[model samples]
Target: MPGPVMPDQAIGTSMRNKDRISAFLTLLPSIILIGIFVYGFIGNTFWISLSDWGGAAALAENPVKSYVGFANYLDLFTGFLGGGFRQDLVNAVFYSVMLLAGAIGIGLILAMLLDNKPRGESFFRTVFLYPMSLSFIVTGTIWRWMLAPQGGVNILPTYVGLPPLRFPWLSSTDAILLFNWQNLLPIALYLVSLVLIIWGLWRLKNNPAKALVLLIPGVVVGGSVWLWGDLLPQALFMEEIHGFNTATFGIIMATIWQYSGYTMALYLAGFTGISQDLRDAAMLDGASTAKYYRYIALPMVKPITISAIIILSHISLKMFDLIFAMTGPDNGQTGHPALNMYLTTFRANDFARGAAIAIILFIIAATFIIPYMISSYRQRRSR
Candidate 1:
C-alpha cells in the first residue's frame, strides 16, 4: 500500500508473456496458410499421385481397389499418362526450357531499354508488364487474335508489301519461327553456349591471337545464333515464312512475347538496386560496355538472374492456361505440354492420368522452386 502498488515493476514476466502471445497471434494467419495451402495440398497431391484413380472416376467402392501402387508412376514416367504414352513428359520439359530461356533473354534486353528511359519508357514498361497482371488465358487470347490466319496482325505484313502473310502461326509449322519460338529457346541458349565454349576453348588452345578472335565471348554467342538460323528449313527462310503450318511456331512466339516482359521487370528492379558508383567506377577505369555489364552489373544482380530463371522455370512447368487458350487441348498429346493433362483430366475426364501429369508438373516446379526458396532463406539470413 505504501508504494501505491508499484504500477509497472510489479511483473515483468506478465509483459513478456503478453509479448509472446502477441507474436504468435501475428503469425497465426501465416501459420494457417502454410498448413492448409502448402502442407495440406502437398500431402493431398502426394497421396493422389500414388493412386490409379483420377477425376470423377477417382471415387468408388470397389472390390480389389486396384492397389495400383506405383503403376501410375511407372505409367507417368513411361508413356501411359496419355494412354498411348508418347514423349509428353519430354516435350513438356523441352517447352519449359524454351520458355525460361526466352523470358530471361528477351526480358533482360527489354528491361535494359526500359531502364534507359527512352521515349515512352512508362508506356513500354506498362506494355511489357501488363501481361503479368492478366491471366494466361488473356495472354493467350490476345496473341491468338494477333497470330490468327485471317487477323489484323497478319495484314500488316501484306500492307507493307512484305507479302508473306497468310499463315495461321499457331497452326502451321511453316512460319516455322514466326511463332515456333518455344523451340528456339533451347536452341538459342545452345548457340550462345556453343560460341562461348568454342571461343574460350580456342583461346585456351595454342594460337593466342586466333584464340583472341575466337575467344571473344560475344562473337562466339552471336555466331551460334547465325549458325542455327542457317540450319532451319529453307522455306522457314521467309518466302516460306508465311505459308507453312506454324502452329508450333506460333505457340513458341506467343510464349516468348508473353513472358519476356515479366523477366524484364525483374531485371529492371534488380538493376536499380545496384550501386551506380560501382558502374561509374568501372567506366572510369576504362572498362568497355560489355566488360562492365559482364563483370560489374552481372555479379551484382546474380540473385536477380537466378530469381528470373527460377520463376520462368516454374511458370513454364505449370504452363497450362496459355497453351490451352491458344491451341486448345487437341495436339497436347504431342506438342502441348499441359495439353495432355488438361484434356485428359477435364474433357475426357481421365482423372488418374491427368492428376498424374499434374504431379509430374509439380515435380518439375519443386525442382526449381525449392532451391530458390532455400536460396531466399539464406539471403534473408545474410541480411
Candidate 2:
C-alpha cells in the first residue's frame, strides 16, 4: 500500500463487492417468493378470519363492505350470530390428542423392535412401513372392507371355530373420552374406575369373570392351535363381543397404522447414521445390548426421536383423510374432528372460522415442532 497502491490491489476489493452483489441478485427471486407465498398468506388468512364475506362473491362485489370487524371472531368463539354454537372444537382437540399419543407410542415401539434385528426383521419393517406409502383414503377403503360390521372382521372368529365377534370401530357411538369415563372427566374418574376394576378383579378371582377377561386372548391362541392341527374348535357359540366402543378405537387404530412407519423410518435412519466406532467402543466397555442402546445409541439418536415426535404430532392434528375415510363424516353429527371442521366451514360459508380452526391446528403442530427446531438451530450455532 505504501509502495504504489496498485491497480491489482483495488481490483480485489472491487471484485469482492461484485461477487456479493451477484449473490444477492441470485437470491432475490427466492426472497420474493418466500415473502409473497408465506407471509402474504398468513396475513391474508388473519384478515379473512375477521371478515364476513359470503364466500368469494361478496369479496368481489363489495370488498369494502365485506369488512365485518371481529363479528366472525365473536361468533367463532361464542355463537354464529348468537345461533348457539357447537362446532366440534372439543372433539377436534380430543381426536388430535388421541392421534398424537397413538402415533408416537406405536412408532417408538416398532422402532425399538426394528433396531433389535430379529428374524425377518426387514420383512416386518416392510409390513410396518408400507402402510405409510398409501394415502389415508386408500387405507380407509381397505380397512373398511375388513372392519365392515357384517362382512369383514365379523366373520373371522366364526371361521376359526369361535363365537362371532364384531366391533364397529368406524361409525358408532363408541366414543372413548380420554378424560371422560362414564361421561365423567378422567381426571375426576380415573381413581374411581381403577379402584372399581381392581375390586372387580379381586372378586373375579373365584368366578367366571376371570375366564371372561381372558376370552379374547384365549380365542386367539385356540384359533392358532386349531388352524395348525385341524382340531375341533372347542370354543363355539362365543356370541360375545370384544373390544367394544368401536368408533373411538377404530380411528385410533387407523391413525396408529398410518404414522408408525414414518416414525420408525426416522429412527432407522438415525441409527444408521451413528458411527461404527462409537458402537464398538460401547461393546468393548462391557455393555449389554440393552445398556448399549439405552446409554450410547439412544443419546445419539435423541435428535431424530425429537424430530419424529414433531412430525407425528403435526400429522395427527390435521388428521382428516383417515377419519373421514374410516368413518363417514356425516354419521349422525357425532364428535369427529375432521368431519366437524368440514361441516362447520361448509354450512356457514365461514372461511374466517375455518381459518381460525386452521390456526388452532397450526398452533398445536407448532407446540411440538417449534421447540425442536429452535433447539436444533441453537445446537448448530454452538458448534
- lDDT of each candidate versus the true structure: 0.67, 0.64
Candidate whose lDDT is highest = 1
Return the TM-score for each candidate structure: 0.70, 0.70
Worst 10 residues of 2 by lDDT: 234-243
Q: Per-prediction count of colliding residue pairs?
A: 19, 3
Listed per candidate, the RMSD to the true structure in angstroms reads 10.1, 15.5
* Tens-place lDDT digits, model 2, residues 1-383: 46877799889989999999999999999999999998888778777767665554543545543567776655544442322222244455555566667776677677778776789999999999998999989987887777788877778888879987766656676533333111222222334444555655555657757645654444444454445433332221222111224365666667677777887888777877788788789889899878877878788888776777677666766667766776676653234444555765777565666666556566666778888889989999999
- The RMSD (Cα, Å) of candidate 2 is 15.5
TM-score of 2: 0.70
CA RMSD (A), model 1: 10.1
What does candidate 1's lDDT look like per residue over 161-231, in tens digits? 78757765766533222322224444555566677667668567567766666557656566665676555
